[model samples]
Target: MFWFLLIAMVVVIAAVTLAVVGGGESDVLPEAAPQHLTDPLPLTRPVARADIEELRLPVAARGYRMGDVDDVLGRLGAELAERDARIAHLEAALAGAQATAADRPGAPGMFDEPPADRPGDLPDGSGERGEDR
Candidate 1:
């Protein structure tokens, strides 16, 4: 009778464990599913500095794929740095040009400041000079 009772208890415990633990299937979404969190972002517009800085990725069962995320962030940082440097260089060039024009003798009032609407003719170097007469 004691053996019978012990066997019945073991069966009850096994049944309860199986019922509580669900099944062998993982609760996490599969990596390959279309609706999965790994979908690529559509970069239709340029990513702003704040957008990149505030970016977050979904966490998987083992957390995010750190190496991949780090690589992308590194690339974004480099690109942002390059853009900032280029903007600074261009601004300095414009300031230098304005200063040079201001210092020239008989310069027009426009020399010390940039016009609100810059004319496109300046880039082609097509200004009418007396030599062309």
Candidate 2:
């Protein structure tokens, strides 16, 4: 009756506990180390848009390591500055070349005068309409 059911339940609980806790034998699962970021940014080549998008910073005890964030920011800043300087230099060189070309005798300029007569027009000043006209 009730006593028989209670005894059966107790035996089942005790068996499960022993099986899980395992009388002090070595467990099947061994201790594992936490995952960490090994190689974040590429050293040989420049960082591309894809690299930035795919970057996953390693998490620290608090949130993220500050050193990694600072390093990435510094590198991106340096690259932008260098690109800006190069752009300015190229723009100056282009302006100088355009000026020299314009000063030459037969170089076409943007401010050239328009022709007095228009094409497809007759002496009467009427333009070509179509075959019907």
Candidate 3:
């Protein structure tokens, strides 16, 4: 029985080795030839001196200037005050113009009487008399 088993094992090993060695095969094809290609042309231009000088000009010459932080704040405050005064003056002028219009003789519906329930008893219906209704 030992001799029979040993012979079978040797036969199996030999068959496996032959199968592995004979299974490999190589396939080869021809290599492709190279083709010529052209390079792209450059499309850039140099800047002129005048262009550089224009870019270097100061901002102040273009009607803008930088001030110190405090100076800018002060100027802003002054401008706001001026605007407030102008607004007040305009409001006063508007009130005066309204008064003058109300006083005009022939303005359309300008002299119309006030309703009975109005707050004041001013004789001219102008509320200037300051009397309680």
Which candidate has the highest TM-score of all? 2
Decreasing TM-score order of the candidates: 2, 1, 3
How high is each candidate's TM-score? 0.47, 0.55, 0.31
- Model 2 poorest ten-residue lDDT run: 123-132
Off by over 4 Å in 3: 1-67, 109-133
Candidate 1 per-residue lDDT over residues 31-110, each given as its tens digit: 67322335343366556667655666755568776765776677677778988999999999989888887788877645
The local lDDT score (0 to 100) that residue 27 gets in candidate 2 is 62
TM-score of 2: 0.55
For candidate 2, write residues 30-102 as lDDT tens digits. Answer: 7566546666777788788898898888787788878888888888888789889999999998888878868
lDDT of 2: 0.79
Q: What is the C-alpha lDDT of each candidate?
A: 0.68, 0.79, 0.56
Q: RMSD of each candidate?
A: 13.5, 6.6, 24.5
Residue lDDT tens for model 3, 1-133? 9999999999999999977775556433356553221221111433334433443212343443444334434644665687799999999988887788877777744445755764356578676544543
Q: After TM-score superposition, what is the CA distance of residue 41 in candidate 2 from its true location, in Å?
A: 2.1
Which runs of model 1 end up more than 4 angstroms from their true locations? 1-14, 20-58, 109-133
